[model samples]
Target chain A: MIIMVAIDPSYLITQVLNGLVWGLVLALIAMGLALIYGLLDIVNFAHGAFYAFGAYVAWQTLLSGGNYWVALLTVPLAMILLGLFVESTLLRRLYGQDTKFTLIFNFGLMLVIVQTCRFIWGARGKPISIPSELAFSVNLGILSYPAYRLFVIALTSAIAIAVFVFLRKTHVGMATRAGIQNREMVQVLGVNIGRIYTLIYTIGICIAGIAGLVASPLFGVYPEMGAEVLIPAFVVVVVGGMGSFHGSILAGILVGQVATLPIIWEPRIAQVMIYIFMAIVLLARPAGLFGELGR
Target chain B: MLEVRDIHTFYGDSHILFGVSLEIKEQEVVALLGRNGVGKTTTLRSIMGLTPPKKGTVLMNGEDITHEPIHRRAKIGIGYVPEDRGIFPGLTVHENLTIAADGVGAPGGNYEDAFKFFPELGKYLPSRAGRLSGGEQQMLAVARALVGTKHVLILDEPTQGLAPKVVDRITHAIKGISKKTSILMVEQNTDLALRLADRVYIMRDGNIVFSGVPQQVRDNEEVQSYLVIS
Candidate 1:
């Protein structure tokens, strides 16, 4: 068939689709990390674990004969409780402590979670077939794309919009933002800053968990899957600028294309693209693209 | 009424406040006069539970609140307008007041009366507090305290950096407020402290060396000399 003969057009389209799909999910994951860092001023090293946990739990729900939509509701709730436990028990102790302790402590938690996941899910990557009702291809003018990719974009964008509005419009949102800017000032205003911190942390992890559940349809469930994207997530966050939501989205898109474009033409060097872009951006603008001045 | 008894406050073992003690009767404007670094602001912070003075009993209307959190102190009718104004820079004047007022319950009894004092606040309710002039910011800070039943109002250096006219305006505003709520004001300007103070305490080295009525403050030549030198 001529389709096999004409690989170039199909290949480029596939790469673009791959980048956009992964980028959307990656942004969701990074947004969670950034929100926690933005408010608490703490690097949540266990965020990748939260993403992995989300995927595993979503997979568990599916294997147990649960509706796919149930994953959306359950994964976030599970991660929220987990986040509350972790923050109240361990993260709370490191509030005024050095960031080095947080990094070390969370990295330890990450190892434990990863090994535990390996113990339960085993070493092999688990296959989670996309729901049959939703399995279809689209003819977008000259190129065909997966319907699942569009769902990934739409669903994640919806989540992001809900989160953005929640943080910007509501009373709790205003209090949380205020607490981020001045926790002591918030306390003076009769707000419970400790409670707000826990709430922000939980919401952040829930976003990551939701990201995992959303991406499970695309990437499948696996233990090492999180490690694969962890570095890139940090790179995207740094590129997007710390604490600025708009910057994170833009950076995620840019980094996504840089990786995919290279992979389309040359598959092996695709992995290096994100790190290269990150280093160049770091050297040029240490604060990231839209990072706050002096940060 | 407010009382501070034997409050020992330390900032990393430097001992900023050394068992300092003071009291203010209801509806009285008590001025705390001291040279810089003599723990005046620290005393205000201790009373506000901002610093949580090490060994002290801060009582508001006979209620023991030495262990009360800062927010609890705020809710329990202690309105603190810090020396810096603490104008929520990103918040508008309206948003600023709303944050202080929008708790789950009704205003703690005297909200309507408090709004009448700062009639100017109603004019610029939509404006950002950070953009307001020094005097206006000071007014907003005071009004914020007033809007939520100020049983004990603490103003730190309300006249510290203001121009002479703004200072006079502030003096009048504070005077107007003194009729409704008890005030514990910390000021370096002796004349402002003296003229406005119902009772004055001259602080030296974190201890009350000279405390008396206005005539006593005016008559103490040594304190007068130190104020000029300070």
Candidate 2:
């Protein structure tokens, strides 16, 4: 019981960096979930399936002789078309109905997507090697870290900032924020809410698609790949406050650390630590860290 | 310029408006007055297509628009200031006006015109709307309507909860606005309605029981009884 052990500072720093990289990826995915829920009021149980589908599509592109850069460029655009089709054909009919209908519908959609992926690609996971330019590690002051992780961090930060500016500055972005608060009033003010909904849903899917493609090299591609991150992403959204953009980013980083940092002392608790953190946060402030009071 | 002809509206299975009919001519202020639960707001909702009349028609410039969507109605130059003010509390005053301006394709130059009515809004353009005082929010609501096309403005109880001082300012704004846009308002304050309106219609049991000029309403004791004015 009194045994003492020395820890390597470099290993600890590496783990922390890993956590940061993972968190940013989670933030990107969770932000999509938050955007769809904020404006459409749909819980979107199928969001994770969309992520898995994106990864598979990227894999297929690579198999057809497309490089990682090409897959990245085209996958999100393809997801936009899929989003347009899904929202207009299926999700459009569910608006104005009970929230339960959409939830159940999305749950069914998720099953369909996952099973379809399994049938097409088989049950085995598919590997996607990192791009040649980013295959090595870069030396930080404390330790060397994979260059791809650094690229992910920089790219995600840029995307987050771009989305923040879009939401705060542009006319359509302002209408979207307004729609989140009061959709009927937005309509009364003469904004076409249906078109706004379509655009938001498309953007949400596109972001999730991008997240999937970006994370594929690290985790490989599989039918159930999205299922692994979906629950944690939900945790990030709830901890950050549902439907809050800034909250998702902050909570994503926090949850990422909680999920990863404990591995040095106890590897068994890594999976459940995020739930514990969420429970403590909920106990302190039931509305979540960034959610509005009484929401 | 706007007419509601024998419109009947229902919420789910329960009927709310029963064959209500009224009209507003070019640049005229028409007040629709009735007691609570008498379907006064429902009549306005029917015209705005918030609750389309199941068995009637609403016409703007002789074109039927009863089935038109709410945003379409607004885009075609029908500005509404709902009973609750309908201010987007999360947005800034400038953003609120911007939405209305964008909705009707109102030019950026019209923002100065809106500010002229309530210069107070210009100072708080950056502040969140929910943080505004009751009087200021009302001014912003009226100012938002003015930023639109000014074809026909529908107001529901714009002064329901404001102070008398605020009421005076709102009254002044409405008086100034009436010269440019046609107004169809449902007001609880009979004296204020009578003062601002060129024409008045009294409703009871979902029907227009009386219609005449403001003086005719004041002189008639029966119309006063329906409004229950002391």
Candidate 3:
């Protein structure tokens, strides 16, 4: 019994690392949702479509005999340009309207995007091999960790840092924050709020794209790739609270812990654990842990 | 050097400003006076093209600007500071000021003149607009409106919630502008507005009820009790 329980925590610790990696993936997707829904008050349901692009682009790069690192860099830039295109053309049209329109319409757009992906890539999962260099696990005294997973952790942490810094220290970030408070007031102050809105949308979607690209090597790419990451991202966004960056991070990790660590006990119900926490969090705080009260 | 002629504007389906019109020349300060919900703000919005006037023309120096966009109007020396004290709360005081001037057509920007009016803004240049006190934000709103190049400055309300002492400072600042620019201000404080205005127009229910020199409109207690307050 002691041996079974002893392997339990080690198994759990390993799962904890898995959960961190998973949470980072969700956090990237959440960054986009947080920017558009949290800050702009526009629920960009089409975000998963962007995530789909990140996975497929990375998939194409791998199939084309290209380096994974080049694919990593190129995919995000492609997503940024894609974000810019969607913003300047379609998203700009929907802004300031009742948000019910965005929710329903973007869902429709999401359907179109998914169908497009299905048409192109077919309805099958494709496994991606880790770059040969990252296949080894690093053994710390207490735990043995996969180096590729560690790379994922490091990359996600770095992206999270960069995101926090951008939102806290940059001009566009400040404008997004103010625009979130009162859009009309910001516009009247002589700032081109239209331009600011576009930038936020681009940045938000690109983050999701990066999340997709990074996850491709680990989970591989599939037509339903968005479905795998999106549910957790929504939960992360909610558990993280609307527009609260740090809240998203903490909540993401916590949700991740509940999902992966608990899976060691009952594999069938591992994913269900996240919903349980989200339900509890909603009942108790509604804003999730670290969520602001008055927002 | 501003002329608003027979402008019509709407809010949804409601016709707010029907043929609203006003004129103010260079170095002159005009007051747009009215009671609540009578479309005073709409008239100003019409001029700035915020609510795109349905029919009418706005001329700055005899040029038709009936369909020109707000920024285009801004480019042609028309600066607007809305009634709401629209401060971009996410920006630092400096960022707020910078965006107003960067890539904007501010000819001979009297940056020094702006500093003279509200030097308090210079101190909190790095602070976000949300962090500043209300009065400082007001100063920032005004400073942004005037920092760039414009010959005509239209302010909806510069002293709405400010203390009397702050109002005095704002009024004094308005009085100090040189002859190169014109000022059009709207205020609820009839006494304070008349004191600063060279010309005043009392608007009632979408039309000009009274228009004259400030002295002529002063102590017109009958107009005050009925139009100004009621």
Candidate 4:
């Protein structure tokens, strides 16, 4: 028996746009992971949990009669405060310890965060309606695309650019890059590297929080929502280069296409294809596309 | 300006410095000379609090800083150029100097003073530090220290792997810097150390074996016995 299916060109365009949107969201999460890893040398397995927490918080805000704009404005600030607390209380003690210690700690922390969400919000997924401003679709030459997804792409791109400028142009940002390269030297040069560490960790967490809040309207808020994206986001980071900021952006978009394009063919194999692509890339370049060897 | 009094330091339980002591007065250039593995680098690390001494005090301008963190020690006017020069290879030369200056709240015009010592660095401001030649990197390291240092600068083997011509340039820069800030340096090149230092301390087995003026070091038999050079 032969199966014949007709594929629409507009559907392909829609899938590509969807891929871009998802990729940008992944880039935000991956950048946070990269920043924390670059400076602190921690993999931060709890990053996904932080994402879930942000979504839940946004959901809570909206349910409490606050608007989507309010959630967007306040969620990152809340994440920053939470990040400060977590870094000082838990991660600080593991600074000089082995990397595996942080891995295990973050893994456990992820479990705690997920369970906390379950206790407070229950186990069902919470839906967030699209904001009225972005509720409509924009007509492209080939297809009509969701305005919210396009907005996500634009906002994320702007954020990525801002982060790049901050790292390259500002004093604290220069120190952060230097610290990522050589933490000891930055300290010896009279920078309070500890403060840089706290700041970086908090900023990273805040970014993850923003990504979570932004994604919630589409993906819905749930205890396990973060875990669903965590692996793919990690793949983005690894493929981009562990600590390279620009690399994450490129890899995120690539992985997003790899994730979404395959759905047009076989949806069941889409997730497996990501890992296979990662394996091939790792085989070709052990350091990933942009990472320095032995970094 | 700086005093290390009988400090004991270890590297994860393997003791590297045992009761080592040294002093640097205002605007004086003091060199610590010793054979390899005799704890010269360890002495510098101890003073910088990279490896905080377990038993003694590190005093800066009469204030004890034995337990102060590395950055705090640097903030209190301790500029350290480690054995490997400690240049952030990924950063640009301009960025390297800027970070050092900002760390200590040095004036914006400090870059010009640093450029005065090594004018070649001015041309390489936008280049990555790792791309610089060894001599340029050493110059950048010293220049970086000069930009932020208020009271004293600490150097560990600044000319370890440089060419002779480069060594002469560094020596000239050191002489120029000495007029501005106190320096505590470790050197294997006894002749160069003696030429640039106002005072010299010789170490053997993590302890100060001999210390005196350059003339006394040349004339003394005991100091010669400790050092490889006669």
- TM-scores for the candidates: 0.88, 0.95, 0.88, 0.94
- Candidate 3 vs. true structure, TM-score: 0.88
Q: In model 3, how large is the Cα lDDT of residue B212?
A: 87
Q: DockQ order of candidates, best first?
A: 4, 2, 1, 3
> Candidate 1: where is the Cα deviation over 4 Å?
A1-17, A93-101, A262-295, B103-117, B123-130, B133-135, B225-230
**Local distance difference test scores for all models:** 0.79, 0.89, 0.78, 0.89
Rate residue A89 of model 1 by lDDT. Answer: 92
For candidate 2, what is the lDDT?
A: 0.89
Task: State in Å the error of residue B22, model 3.
Answer: 1.3
Off by over 4 Å in 2: A1-6, A293-295, B107-110
Q: Judging by TM-score, tell me the better candidate of 3 and 4.
A: 4
Q: Per-residue alpha-carbon lDDT of model 4 for B133-209, expressed as tens digits?
A: 99999999988877755689888998989999999999999898889889899888888999999999999988998
Query: For model 3, what is the C-alpha lDDT against the true structure?
Result: 0.78
A1-295, model 2: which lDDT tens digit per residue? 1221367789888888889988998998899899898889999889899999899989989989999999988898889999999999999999988999999999999999899989988889999999999999999987899999999889888888888899999888998999988888888877889999999999988888888998999999999888988999999999999898889999999998999988978999998999999999989978788887754
The better-scoring model by lDDT among 1 and 3 is 1
Q: What is the DockQ for all candidates, taken in turn?
A: 0.39, 0.75, 0.27, 0.75
Span of ten consecutive residues with least summed lDDT in model 3 chain B: B102-111
| TM-score (chain A only) for the predictions, listed in order | 0.91, 0.96, 0.93, 0.96
Q: What is the lDDT of residue B153 in candidate 4?
A: 86
